[model samples]
Target: MRCLVRERNKTRIGVTALATLAVVASGTAVVTAPEAAASFPRGEWNETAYRGQVEVIPAKDDRSDRRVLRGKVFVDRDRDSVSDPGERGLRGVMVSNGRDVVTTDARGYYELPAYDNMTVFVTQPAGYQVPVDEYNIAQFYYHHLPQGSPELRYGGIAPTGPLPEAVNFPLVESRATHTKDQNCVIAGDLQTYDKTEVEYARKGAINDLAQRHDYTGCGVLFVGDIVGDDLSLYPDVKDLTKSLNGPVRFLPGNHDLDYDARTPEHSFDTFRAQLAPAYYSYDVGRVHVVALNTVRYPCTPDVDNPDGKRPGCDDPENKPTYNGRLDERQLEWLRKDLAKVPRNKLVVIASHIGLVNYADEGSPVHQVDQVREVYDLLKGRKAVAVSGHSHSIENMKTGDLAKGWSDLFGLKGLPFPHITAGAISGDWYSGQMTEDGYPIAVGRDGGRPGVVTLEIEGNRFRERYTVTGQSDRFQTQLGLNTPTYRDWYEARQEWNANPEGPAPELGDPHVVSRDDLAGTTWLTTNFWMGSTGSRVKVSIDGGPARWATRTQQMRGEDQNVGPEWSDPHAVAQQLVHGGSVADRSMHLWRFALPEDLAVGTHRAEVTAIDSYGRRFTDALTFEVVEQR
Candidate 1:
């Protein structure tokens, strides 16, 4: 798959009514680097008004050169960035030496001689828009590095010595022009393990994109995990992009990696060659999009380290074992990238690894290192950082930015928002099958597999999550704890029990019986559970339920940690009272029916289950009508 580079768009120099911006073998026209010129005229800038140009005049003594090449670029009048049939190439479109100018050929292409350190940029015409990154930074057409740029201590384009002569620029004709006008789509991890799963994604996402035209105008940005470490699937992903109505951009994830990346520099060589800037900035409308590379490849192998080592970088074993962090260079580049952006413009920092304090706060593996520094960088700006890789949904509205980093660094609440965009693959390789016979990667948090859309007006943006092939109705929050749920859970537990001898008889998977409904309480009975130390609850007829203390400790099959004496999942072994059911999988929850109920046909349902082990109810039943 071809990794496309969508760059940051900065303010383009505005060229005036100059008919020709040409520089010949010099007589006396001053020739210096372009950046030495004044700021682009603010009021003169427009989407349709093409500006900025450079003259390729040779040195005074060297008059032997006769070849003069020149061309002009504008928002493709026909809207195709590439030149096409019947579309007139804009002529007389001025390019300059920051003073004098030149125009285009019949083909609408422009050129200038190779010059040293010249900042050659296109003049944005009136009523046309430029592109930007999530950080609201504009993209420069080309760095024009003839000798190549310097190596950035942090990260940036290497310094190329000079701009080459055949300097032609491309522009997609955009009409509705405003610094504030832009649209963007955010896609989380598209982790597919095999070709079948790739086809599954094709059936799900590709089918959805084929029908979407709204996003065609802006383009799509895919947050990492493009492939499940199996880089071979990238071409298939590229095939999927053809279905997209707009340009496709990508940021790398742990899965999209060079397994041989022993050091940080080699981390994304494969990805860089495929995608654009690994951690770079681009602009669209008033927003600056900063895509970051957060998966840090350890230079030192931990193969013999105390903790268990992982297999291939794509393997599931490798994920949790490795910590996610932005290397020192990326962090530095971020600081500089942000410094260039105006504070008023909205900045969207996109990364594969989210900041610390995700699902497992204490676990450094899930969080980003130096996150506090990252958060601190956006102190006063209107900014939001979005990431995916956790494969779950969490919109943490925390004023406390350093809640996860305070101990390590003296950091505090962040001034902006950090949103963890839910993964497109949902629970990685888990989920049921869809009608198309593809495994449905339904999100564990009840969110539908989809993309996020940002509507920008001025510097303000409203973010909306769009589910693939479905309407907003599919966006939901699951509620638990009705009497029906209690019975279903009990039955579900019994049904899913691992076969020690034999499995239970087949019955209605959704039904809740009176016996199971009695003492109607269901526990989450596992280790990953127990928020704030809350446990099981039992209740009947929507009344208050009492908590059930763990008597016996049960452990997961994979559990081999410290002494099982304190493991909550291990402690829940008491409820495994009878029968040879699987230990860790069986979560026993119980609730008793109300005492005052004059039994006829009473109904119960588990409507909701909270993090605190609290369960809500929605239940009803028909009594004998009192025989009046």
Candidate 2:
């Protein structure tokens, strides 16, 4: 929602922060933009330390004699991180120790069976908001690791000398979160691998979030892969979140795991220390969001990896691998957590790896192994599933079927809608650089980098995608997949494989010759979050609107891959510039153009109506030439 204007000096200047409701006479919230990438300070930066950390009162002893963990979910009227006298305790707030889910008593006091290395947290109830650090990271959990992490590469959790007298979670009342209409943002894979990538993220998605004010209550959930493999960058990554105005919550992805850890239990110790619990749940308005740790790194061979590709985990001689499956404890926690949520409330199940997706539809190592079980638990309830990991944007509705999902899981169709909320580091932040300061990073499935927002009303919700550096209405990408372009795509692929000559050029993508029309040309529309009921209508030169057929219908068929199903708009960037090929997608739709058109410039307008009946418009101008 940040409007950026290019200055005469060719430097990008952000026009507004949009966080403050205050607007100018023109209704613009003009504020200074983020400093340029080079402007970032080197070395350690804990600028957010002034905001303070999670509240705790540790015991004087190195260890505790207590067998139970106690905490209070109290209202912090003074806005301090600690609970003060006369600040009333909030009643019935959900609290958990990673496994058991329990609610506070009438006094806001709750206890859970305490164990070593447990994270005790309280879920912020509707009308209440958990305090966020200066970096905007929510501080609601206390990691009770007596001896700390086992000397991890990132220095995992520090030694918690002893259990605290109380791990009180403070909350402030919020009018934004108390309402039935909530816009919750779900972002996939900020996955910045280094400081450079961190700058890219800050300029791209982080900047987009900094300027957004609609999600102050429900907040933003970074589904997984908060960072790539380098855990040391966690501090810098946290700094990027400083721009956010909402509570930032994260679930661990395979990339976030401690690869050196020999045991799966310790795989995410560092993540827990720096970010969040491996799995957690919270409430916003009438929606109950359950974030699950679906990635099991160092996966043992004994566990069934049905139709998966993870080669090893049992051998100590080699590096441990990861599989998409929930730990038994986490699975049980999900069951217990859902039981307490009201049946009338909408349930949003978020995870690192998707329960099911078009990108990894056939690989159990990428999709959750216990998807069926998870579905059964949410059965008869108004629930939807969301995830990251695949880096593709998929909006699969209930009953939608994919051949891989069917073969891998022995499942015929989806029971609930499952969305793969694209990625911030699209294609690992590959492709050509843009003036906006990041790479094109078009996803393998052809969707651009973006974030998904679920607008919930009562027990129902609608999903909308906002592309990075773009507005909410920027939903569709249009390109011509003409015969000439497809051939150039193949030629470029071959050239990239063996560099003897210059790469093939996708010349004048919008302009196609008569030969191209004679051979065949289809107008491709990459509708980022398009689903079963979505429609794409194209009108040429203000003529009647005509429907475009979706390339892959997601109806029990295999992926319609290769150049034919590719988005030329995305492929042109991927092939010549760099990054993953946009060779396949479930959201791409194609409409054939008339071959008998006169040789001249023509204009076409596209109207894409999503399943929720929200309409978006885009247009393309092209010349019908006699020859190239």
Candidate 3:
């Protein structure tokens, strides 16, 4: 960001009303506004000495009856840590104690029911910027743990003696963040298991992000599984944040849980201590993004999994498991949070486990158990749900249906767009090594590693996923599926085992025989984010374009699975290189050519149209021969 973000703005409310608070206001030290759009020489946070922390004022009176946590959300006018004269409190900013949410009053003062080990945080309101540390981590919350976390591995939060008298949150008014146009990045699953995978992420996705300057306005929200099971690597994850030029927020996934904890209440304490609140919401532009901790760890059948799908929870010998369910407190908190958001604003519900997933559509444990309730809550609102865990990219629009959704969720069609943002560490960063020091790590459904961006102007949005190491123009992967290829596909069904004889050679993917044309040969296009309303058109040798048929109709049918429906292009790589096969994608489209076409070279001009009416064109050349 070239321009300064700390410039003062004209006031709306009079100064007389600011008398209640002493010190006030803050804005970005350096941020690129849409008006003054530009990039920084370095791909790093716009950090400066203006970095600030939350103010924790010690208590004066000690009656030992502090049931409610009280604080003020003030604009740190001087960017000082303390609230002084002329600095006014910001009103209507929501604050939460990790559960119950409350908004600040006209005076920017708020009181919420607090408990032990709770984190009191202010949801950084739109048009305002929160103070960030040198590491660019947002400093908006105060952890209140009187006794600290119990002794365990990775050393949890240290002890704090008592709750503060007032925990004032300091924010700066940033025109950089105040704009109606926003390109909010909704990235999912950078689940690096160790240092190697961490390095891969740095070189792959993080490096790709550094070259772009689009997200400084609204910033980036990593939807969960920030790392694998190792809590110790949080610092390494922070190092990756250095490459970004935007404010970053995180949501916890199942792998982020503290498995050492004996109970569910403490499952994510380590994550909260190291990263962010287990669940929270913030506003940017006209969108209210709700980041949810959907993975419930140490799930018990009695409370967390009442539906009985998690039968292992009842077994004495079984290790405590995780399930896709929201605790009562979070559910209640979501209700309150959504109530405050106006009907006109777009509500983006971001989570780790998707509300509904195409990859794990039949598994009860993979999707949220309270999907119906979530849908009910989102009624009469323009909303979208984006999640990560599945590792596949799916763009399911409203009115799209699946049999598993009908059978398990009792959902015939989606209430809103439910997109499964493809992972940064695609398939756990597994596959043949790349020259740039990473893996191809193609996703299970053939989608490559990528990040999803929601470009919004006011309340509405257009979504797109950019493949890592590739430009945004690259969207679809084209391939050929023939009768002979299917035979080789079935022979290589054992994904890990090597064939006894020489593997069948698909000599030239472009070459086709009369037998191939006669026996249901198809031209496959893997449009990663394609969905019900998306279209794929093919024109043979520059002839008039014809629409291609989508493999999985998504009209209340089970998975249109196996080799025939698989992305043969991705399958060839996965079978030989590594990772899950590209069988049964929600976005695969196919077109069959006429069997009697004259034997000659042919060119297929492909055009893919997304639901938002964005058009992308690609082409492939092939040949029709008398014999193979």
For residues 77-171, write the lDDT of model 3, one tens digit per residue. 86654566578988889998877888899989999887887778888888888876544566678777777788757656666555667788888
* Model 2 per-residue lDDT tens digits across residues 27-129: 1122211222123333222221112234455444545678787767888665544455687988888898888999999888888998887877777788877
How accurate locally, in lDDT, is each candidate? 0.48, 0.80, 0.80
Worst 10 residues of 2 by lDDT: 24-33
Residue 614 lDDT (model 3): 90
Candidate 1 ranges with C-alpha deviation above 4 Å:
1-169, 176-183, 299-322, 400-414, 444-447, 477-498, 504-628
Clashes of each: 100, 0, 13
Q: For model 2, state the Cα shift of residue 1 in Å.
A: 30
Native-vs-model 2 lDDT?
0.80
Candidate whose TM-score is highest: 3
Off by over 4 Å in 2: 1-54, 60-65, 304-310, 314-317
How big is the positional error of residue 341 in model 2, measured in Å on the Cα after superposition?
Answer: 0.6
RMSD of 3: 6.3
Total backbone clashes of candidate 2, pairs 3 or more residues apart or in separate chains: 0
Pick by TM-score: 1 or 3, better one: 3
